[model samples]
Target chain A: MSFTTPTIDWAAFAPIIIVLGAGAAGILVEAFVKTPATRRTVQLALSLAALVASLGVIIAQWAALDGAGTVVMSGMATVDRQALAWMAILLVFGLLSMLLFASRDGGGAFTELGATAPGSVEEKLARRAGLQLTEVYPLALFAVGGMMLFTCVTDLVFLFVALEVFSLPLYLLVALARRRRYLSHEAALKYFILGAFSSAIYLFGVALVYGATTVTDVNMIGTAIVNLADADPLLLAGAVMIIVGFMFKIGAVPFHSWVPDAYQGAPTAVTAFMGAATKAAATAALVRVMFVAFAPLEWELSWLVWAVAIASMVYGTVVALVQTDIKRMLAYSGVAHAGFILVAFAGLEGEALTALPFYLLAYGLATIGAFAVVSQVRERAEDGGVGAEAVRLGQWAGLGKRSPLLAGSMALFLLSFAGIPMTAGFIGKFEAFSAAIAGGAWPLVLIAVLASAVAAFFYVRLIVLMFFTDAPEGAEETIAIEDGALTRVVIYVTAAAVLVLGILPSGVLNLFADASVLLVSVGG
Target chain B: MNPMNYVILAAILFSIGAAAVLLRRNAIVAFMGVELMLNAANLALVAFSRIHGELDGQIMAFFVMVVAAAEVVVGLAIIIAVFRARQTISLDEPAELKG
Candidate 1:
């Protein structure tokens, strides 16, 4: 038998290609580049340029697309407006995060040598030599590329591959924090094991799905379901398992044990990247799986979605209320945000299609911006030098008095998180709640509203501490504010985006509305 | 031989693997559990492919194997790094970050 070759649409696939290509080139640079300082500069420039170029290509493709979208690579992937929108959002996040990664004013975020033991002589020597872990740029690119692919791939096996491709890099990145080396290592180990375990479960689900339907292409599976007289037990089990895996990535409850540990343990810059981009990508993939592949099972799966969404909101908000550490608080807050995003899935209606993307965009911006602010607030050493990050809740007291701009930005992000009016979070929550209402999932929306009100208490408490509370006696000199140039730019961009999207959301809302169409493979 | 039997055997193995991951404290053993889970999925895939008369399941099994191997590399590296830092690989030992 002769094999026929499937043609690829190179232009349509250019954005993913550019980012992954840049990642491969970066590895070569790591091998060839001699000087650490020069290598850092080259890697930063390369990563930023690649992300910007990919963004441009996506915009161009968006303008050129006429129909729903085309299935390329013999139906292994689809390039639709929905996927393009998610790709653009992820690229913007990558651009901002890359800037954060390159910021070195406060001794940077990643360790000089990942292999060296913390506080050991070799670690000190590496630091003294001015060495830096510049490989993060490439790893981030690989992750961005994988996440982009994750949004668009059509086949279940390809989806599994994309999930791992993005996850592996992030697992490694979590371990490279300059401070709290042991904590970072523990986080990586836990994240790696749990992530692998979830993927295995997801793969078994995929296999069972294939076994039940004799097909792996998502659209084909949907077609098979339509033809079948009854839903096969294997198919249902597999679908649930598949979604469970995605839930772990999204950090939803029952599968969310890793979220806080990983978020708090990772370097602030890497956390910012993962917090923003990973959720957006995973949510995008979930929307696809739920909407395109498993829409027929909506009746059966709605309860699962509702249960997880409510659990995440209640559990996340309650735990976040008591977190003494800023990073850990944000991690629980992320879990709550995951629930909010899932709220759009309640009705499985068209409005949710627009609502989810907008919600993720708003949430991602606030998360990245907030974390950037966290990275800038450092601990003051005995000799008056900046040390590791000041993560305690009390350390932030009277921050507004010392640096109004930083504190104002932090306050803005916190308000956005609370879904207060005149911020992106407000519009995001409104759209999501309205979407759920339209889907006839009003009860879920009611619980979500209650959760939001409770979540706001802690968010506002932090605001009060920053603005109104006085620094405790003899603690006035404990917090040092470092003006890292790159971090400042990230904060400005994200905060501004948050406001613009909040106030004049019509432009983005309209764009998301137009891009909500998912293209199923007709060939399959 | 019924190919369905193979699928049932795969399911049993998957449960054992899951049990090991949840119950075991040693990092290496937990990792082994994950690998076993993956291999069991491969068995199910091949068995299903045999029953269905399609190459897609077999091809997917190959892809899973390659990805699983890559996972082994990364997982071992992370476990090694943790060991070097703390002189132990017990999952219960790292209590620094409260789950």
Candidate 2:
């Protein structure tokens, strides 16, 4: 017998490895060289550096991506343009989160809260009174690194491990806010327990999958299933188990109850991370599993996804309408968006998978920015209330008069959510819908459109409040722009990109097409 | 030892461990269950390698063991911190998250 060792591609793994390495180093720096100022700076600087390094690597990968991704390191991972796109989006979200969380509690434009708020002496004084969320950068970055690794993982073992790495950090971040420990802690514990349960279920599913195929490599499983093309109960069981795990993680319908609670109870910055990056990773990994390994079983998983997607859409929209709290409404709105993303999944057999990447980018940016605005508006602890109570749509009354920039930004995102022409959100949904329609999924498209219309009501409701209502006496409290320059930069860029993509969507459409072409999933 | 017998025993143990991880709420028990599951997998992988006269499965098993150790260590620390702060290991009691 002869044995040959498969070469590992350390270079291909560089982008993710860098982030993980930084996370470890940042903890070490804080542990040994500990001072409050140093603690903040070390965590903040390390996080920014890690993401920046990942971005630089992403640029290099993009430049070289003409037939670029090769299965590296004995086929442990496949580095492709899609992975690059997902990582890029995650990194960008991390950067934006850092910026949005930039300010400290002292009176500054980028305050931890109401720093740049409107109103006279009273509102400013009130802004000064709100509770502060400190050292959010390290936690946010830790989660980002987890997400970036999740996108690049090629095999199932690596996939599950990476998922937990990203997920655990976020569970902790939710509880770590200096103020409002009770709300935040409770949220964290709930998220941790359930998230861990979901992960264990996911891992067991992976185990079953390994048992069925007698193989752990994902692409190899794809090869095995296609080669056999028969009803191996074990294999089917494995596939079913794996699909259930993925389904739960993405918060599709039955598994979605955890989402709103986690989103509403978590500190806003943590909420932003979970809303944007975690969902992106979980969805991206799902596409990798179903579309990549189980493409042969499309006959099976497709219908299941369709049912979940439809339920998610209708449930999300209906529940969102009656919610009085702004964050809760957005939480339901998120559930609806999850349905839209899955609608793209329902067409997994063809050009529809292309929409997955672009749709995630669009949805993530808009959602992150929306949450950022929410974080900024909620009142501080010193303001003599629990963590910010500013969610009522009417509370946004007269926002246009006071903090025009914040209101305008919120309006832009809301319109994008409404899929108004010319914003990235519209382009994203349009592309996904077009692909679904191309796949001859008329009913799904029609339902998706109707749900979009229903969902639009609440998104526009906030707009009317922002533009019409007189800023409730306290509504003029401007959101302190956090000092993290990157968060604001990301928000501005995404908000602007929303408009730009809306205008010349063809460029993005072309990118989506080319990117979609490379997906080795069911259709392409 | 018969390699096939080892494989079957490992599979049984793996299932038992997975069930424990799923059905139990005590953090330490869950951690022990995870450890059991990983060790069972390692045993199976090693047994298969001995039967097939291969090294790949053995190496993979070794890696799994290493990761299991790391996971148990970190996971236990986090659970401990949570328990210390809240003074309870009953996982069902932390249900304040509903909006």
Candidate 3:
């Protein structure tokens, strides 16, 4: 038999191509560019340019789209408005994260040498030589590209590939934090083990699903379900396992053990990037899977969503209340927000399509901006030099008196996280809850509303510490705020976005509504 | 022997791998368990591909093998880093960050 190669639509794939291509080129730059300073500048410029160009291409694709979307790569992926919207969000996060990564002279967050033992002679030498792990720029691009693919891939196997493409880079990046090397390494190890285990489970699930359906394409799985007289146990089991894997990535409960550790242990810049973009990518994929592949199984599968959503909301909010560490608290808060996003999936209504993306955008902005604020506040070392991040809750006391701008922005982000009116988080929560209500999941929405109130307590407590309380005696000189220009840009942009989206959400809400439709390919 | 038996064997092996991952403390052993689980999935894929007279599952198995190899490189690099820092690769060794 003669085999013919499938034709590729190059333009449709250009966005992912551009980012991953830049990532590949970055490896060459790392080798050839002799000077560390010059290499960093080149890598930073390359990463930013690639992210911006990809964003441009996605917008062009959005405007020029003729129909719902086309199945590109011979059914390996789809490029619908839904995928385009997610891609745009991921790109924006990528751009902001690249800026954060480049801030503080490209060496603020990451270690001087990843392979060197912390506090060892080699580490000291690397630091003195001004070596930066500028390779983080390339790795971030790969992750962005992988996340973009994760949102759009049509086949289950391709989805698995996309999952790894993004996750591997994150695993490496999580370990490169400059401070708390032991915690960073531990977090990386745990993340890698759990992440790899989950993906293996997901792959097995894909295999079983392929066996039952005789196809791997998600839309084709739906068609296969329609044709079958009864639901196969294999298909049911496989679908649940696949979702379990997605939940692991989304940092929901029972599978969320790694969330706090990784978030706290990772460099704040990496945490900001992962917290925002990873959730958007995983949520987008889950939405596609639920709407397209598992629509027929909704009645059977939704209880799982309900159970996880409730657990994440209750557990996340409760645990976050007592946490003293800023990063750990935010990590738990992220778990609760994950629950809020899942509430939209309750009724499986079309409205969830719009609600989920908007919620993620709002939540992501607040997350990145808040983390940027965290990155700015440093602990004062013994000799009066700037030390590692000041992460304890008490350390933030009287921040408003010292750095009013940073403190004010931090308060705004916390208010937004608490879903107070006049911020994006408020609008995001309203949309999500309304979508759940429309889907006949009012009970879940009620629980979610209560969780939001409880969550507000912790968020507001942080605000009180920042603005209302005074620094304890002899602690006045403990906190040092770094004036990183790039980080300030991120904070300003995300804060402005949070306020604008909250006040004038109509345009964005309409945009999300219009782009909510998923492209369903048939017959493989 | 029936071809379906291969699928059964794969499932049993997957269970064993999962159990090892959850119970074992040694980082390398747990990592080995992950590799076992991946290969078990590959076994099932190849078996299913044969049963269906289709090439998709076999092609997928090849992709899984490649991805798994890449995973090994990263995983071992991380494991080595942890070992170098802490002098042991026990999963329970590091407890610096706690709630």
Model 2 spans with C-alpha error above 4 angstroms: A1-6, A105-142, A348-350, A380-389, A392-394, A471-490, A518-524, B1-95
lDDT of every predicted structure (CA atoms):
0.92, 0.70, 0.92
TM-score of each: 0.99, 0.84, 0.99
In model 3, where do residues sit more than 4 Å from their true spots?
Answer: A105-107
Worst 10 residues of 3 chain A by lDDT: A99-108
lDDT per residue as tens, model 1, A182-257: 9899899989999999999999999999999888888888888887789788989999999999999999998999
> Which number leads on DockQ?
1
The candidate, 2 or 3, that scores higher on DockQ is 3
The list of candidate 1 runs beyond 4 A from truth reads none
Q: What is the C-alpha lDDT profile of model 3 across A324-364, one tens digit per residue?
A: 99999999999998899889988555799999999999999
Instruction: Point out the higher-scoring one by lDDT: 1 or 2.
Output: 1
